[model samples]
Target: EEPYVAVVYSDYLHLVCSSCFHEDAPLLIRKCKEAPLEACKGCHEVYYCGSACQQNDWKIHEAECKFLSTAVAVPSDIVRMIARLLIRRKRGDHDTFRAYNGRKFDDLMDHRSDFENMGANFDKVFNDTKNYVSIDYMVDREEIVRYVGKLLVNQFAIRGPVDTCIGNGLYIGICIFDHSCQPDLTRRSIGSKMILRSQNREQTLNKNLTVSYISPLACTEERRKLLRSNPFFFHCKCRKCEDTEQDGYARSIKCESCEGGICLVKDDSAPLRCMKCGITSSITHEEANKWNADVAIVEYFGSEDCALFIRKSMHIFSPPNMRDLAKKQS
Candidate 1:
């Protein structure tokens, strides 16, 4: 059960339960002990799980319903979310919220400065969010800006079983997790809640917990660029970003040298290597044979030596000026 739950407009909410966020909300709601969902007459677009859910959600949705019942350009998703949060705060389930983020909401990371660093186009986006607030919500523009930044950096997209995006939600408790190019945690949303389990949930405790914010299928540079743009304004320095070999195999191909081996970014400068055979189509036989001599030594070497040797091999096999190997394969 969530301390709080919020849903988008009914058109977007669709068959999903507005209160609990269940996909089969309408069908399951029919089996409820309570009366059926109350559809708002104003728009015939809003529905609630029950009377209590209707009243609770109505506290915020009323204004939206009335406004939406009429013709107006629908607000951006972020603007609508900010509006909902403002009204929900007034309903005031203070104690329930205190358990997370110390309930300040202010304690949430501020991406305002991050946007400032990005320059004026970001400022325009922030300004556009503010423009949506003026007549509908009597809110402080600065407060809206802060919440907008928080939502951008913190909200998690609610995905269906097939990885289709169902909606988006914000959970203060789970937002504290730092991201990695290769995540240790996998996110699964059940209705309104975001659950993080160990990528290997069988074992618990501390084992380098992490989660990927972007697809690891992209090569290192692509992931870094995506993370540094818009919402996430920082370049990733994760191990995978530093070493291209960590690229996920979804984008990889079968190696010519060893048909069984996956050809992946083994050299940061250019060549793709056969993971099992340690052979590269781009690396000449003479060079590969020489490099292969160090494999046993690399295996026995300390972590620091292994890293250095790998870098040396990359420089030797694919000079820095050469084009990226993954792009060529793509």
Candidate 2:
């Protein structure tokens, strides 16, 4: 049977080596035979294979390590323990005696008493180093449980797994960029490290733009629908969604003043407002092309330029033929 896998959403707790962009040294330890004689002298948490690798990485690693160490504030030992537990849980090599579905996973975890000893050890460590370690802050219990459950189901505990090659569950911080119909981010995997690259030529983005982890290839309506149903409960009120012209293709509404050219905003109380003119007028579905001609074009183009072209052509001149527009965009 194929092993269960979990997709861990990236967060902000991981430390990456500057020299190699490696997420964790313990994961790298598998690749190297000899351990460094001395750990990172300042941040005792991160060890190295040798002084050469450490020295080579000092310039970038030092600043990032200092910032991370200060911000995270948790003890290295505790974090390592959590990581080990995750790794152990991911290594499920024995025959699938049981299905290990979500129900079974919950049942096993409900037997918290089985792992009570480990909890005791945690408490002991916390009590012993009360001054050195910060324990007052509350962690999201559900997040930890979900992650630990993933680790156990994946059997990362036993090691030798391809997914565990870089150690999963650790959150590496990446700069946030705003969502767009056309996104600039690209994911590249090098060994165990997943690198996010900016496909755009510009090195810096504007201040007003918001950053998002998800892809922006989806249509405005589809994106809105996803935002509504997603765990993150918030409607996306982006400029794209506000465009009545685009909504016309979704069979939303049409403006009477502009004939078939302008689309109307859909609201029971709000009258149909022409997108081109500020005229408040309504039209029937028969008057306008009930089907969206631009949607197919936008889907084929899959880029900001295509969206811009469609918006301009529809609003200004005649709406382009879907086939010709789609081919050009593609």
Candidate 3:
């Protein structure tokens, strides 16, 4: 799906193409490398791969060209995207685009109550955006704030090589898909567009397509907490979220009786039961908690290497556990 608006992060303005969102030399495709990126002469804050890219991006960049030149520093990624949306609205371009379900920008959820509660945090971002956008585009402050809320919640992170986030983009059509902890659809970012692919084409053909807004590797509690958090405020009752058995398996411990088998402890008062062999496990919940704590330490404050993290966590987390899957994927 094509993005309504896309912007490179301020830190990557020089390294990434602002128009196509391509890296200077994309990994594994050295032959596709283009001439060195050139900063826009008008603003000098945005870069393009070539004249064609610069010309293509000029339509949206033109609105903020002079203003960006005047600013002490470039606005934040979200602010730049908001400015582009406002400029598009000012140019009567908002109505030109429609979502997969024919929803327009005004039809999208703004979650006004949540943003209002944000108070100073939201105000500060809006105020910063105002400095870069023209007065004509700022005629409707309330409407702008609404767009702020809409974009914050709807924007998709544009990922590059090795799933590194290069920037943010808004694809209204793709936003129509609901969030699921175990998603039916997976998204891949190519240039400025997003492609949603089905995990199981045959099974998902007639099913409602869902995507994981947060990492699919996240545990049920972590997934629900993130889904219900700010910018994406909604309690997820997805199949994965409602499955208690799945949650138990995720927190299971290595079995003491059986080789390579895992045991599940129903509660603190109960004995751990091996899933592979029906044997009662001698392992206690305290041991499981300690293993979890060790993984957390290495994950947050210890090693930065994903391979090392995964190696350290393998024996601790059971194979079927979400944390185990998360580490392996990382």
Candidate 4:
């Protein structure tokens, strides 16, 4: 699938082939050609393996050349990405580019109101966009803001074969897949392209495919917090997000009544009920905060003794609590 717009990060300008976005390695770089990489005569901001590669990307880069040539410094990854998108939209690229299901670029979701409610955060982005993008390429102020919000929420990290992030891109089809903490599909990247595959035989017949937008290893609450921030400003209603009992088990407290653990009950303000012994235990806010802090310290510091001490204090949820396993092995 072709990307609607993509830009290699500034830090990787020289290392990656801007046109093909081939991985940076001696052998791979040599595979393209031993000839020294060429920089755009106008901007010197992008690099290509050879003239042919440069020519291939020239269509998109042509619009950016003039702006980049006169700029004081190279724009940021997101900034450059947004500029390319704006240029494409102004030139009517959105009308011709379609997803697998024939969804046009204009069909993409735009959370303009959400960004508007963001106040100063949204203001900074809008101002930065205006500063970098030339006046000729820009649309009305509201239209630019709408595109900015759309790109923020829909852009994907262009990662290389080894799973190293090389750039950012906007793919119309990939954007259609919704986010889930527990996804039914697996995704891998090759250069500027992404490949999604069903995880199991059952998933092949499934209609509602999903992929993790955030790290699945993170606790449910942490994942939810991230999903509700900057790029994704919506609460998740995935199976994992709705599993309140499972979430409580992850942060369970020790129950003194039956030497069992008591998990926090979702949507209930009363005392927690022990999952094992059916006894109620009242815990203070301070206690919960302390437990969370201790877990964080052990995870960050990787002190085996500290982990063991914490492990003995509660009934840890299995598998996801790999730290406990490591502590036990230690």
Model 4 misplacement above 4 A = 27-31, 34-36, 120-124, 201-207, 244-330
Q: Which candidate is the best by TM-score?
A: 3
Candidate with better TM-score, 1 vs 4: 4
**Candidate 2 error regions (>4 Å):** 1-85, 88-171, 178-200, 205-217, 246-330
Candidate 2 has a TM-score of 0.29
Tens-digit per-residue lDDT, 1-330, candidate 4: 567788888888988888878855655534467766788887988898888888988888887888788788887777788788888877787888787767777888887777667762555656777888888887666776777777888888877644467888888887888899767665555656666766365555233778878665455667788999877898988876799766555555666576435555343455666667877666653455355445534422335655665567445332334334344233
The alpha-carbon deviation from the true structure for residue 249 of candidate 3, after best TM-score superposition, in angstroms, is 2.9
Give the local distance difference test score of model 3.
0.73
Query: What TM-score, over all chains together, does every model reach?
Result: 0.65, 0.29, 0.78, 0.71
Per-residue lDDT of 1-330 in model 3, one digit per residue for the tens? Answer: 778888898888898888888888644231224578888998888888888888888888887787798888888877888888887887777787676667677667888898667552567677887787767777456776788888888889998654668899988878877888767776777777798766354654323678878765445666777888788888999887898576567667776677878886333446777888989866676676555444433222223555566666666667765465464344
* Each model's lDDT: 0.57, 0.39, 0.73, 0.69
Better of 2 and 4 by TM-score: 4
Predictions: Cα RMSD each: 11.6, 17.7, 6.0, 7.6
How does model 1 fare in lDDT?
0.57
Off by over 4 Å in 3: 26-33, 118-121, 203-207, 248-257, 263-330
Worst 10 residues of 2 by lDDT: 1-10
Kindly indicate the candidate among 3 and 4 with the higher lDDT. 3
Candidate 1 vs candidate 2, lDDT winner? 1
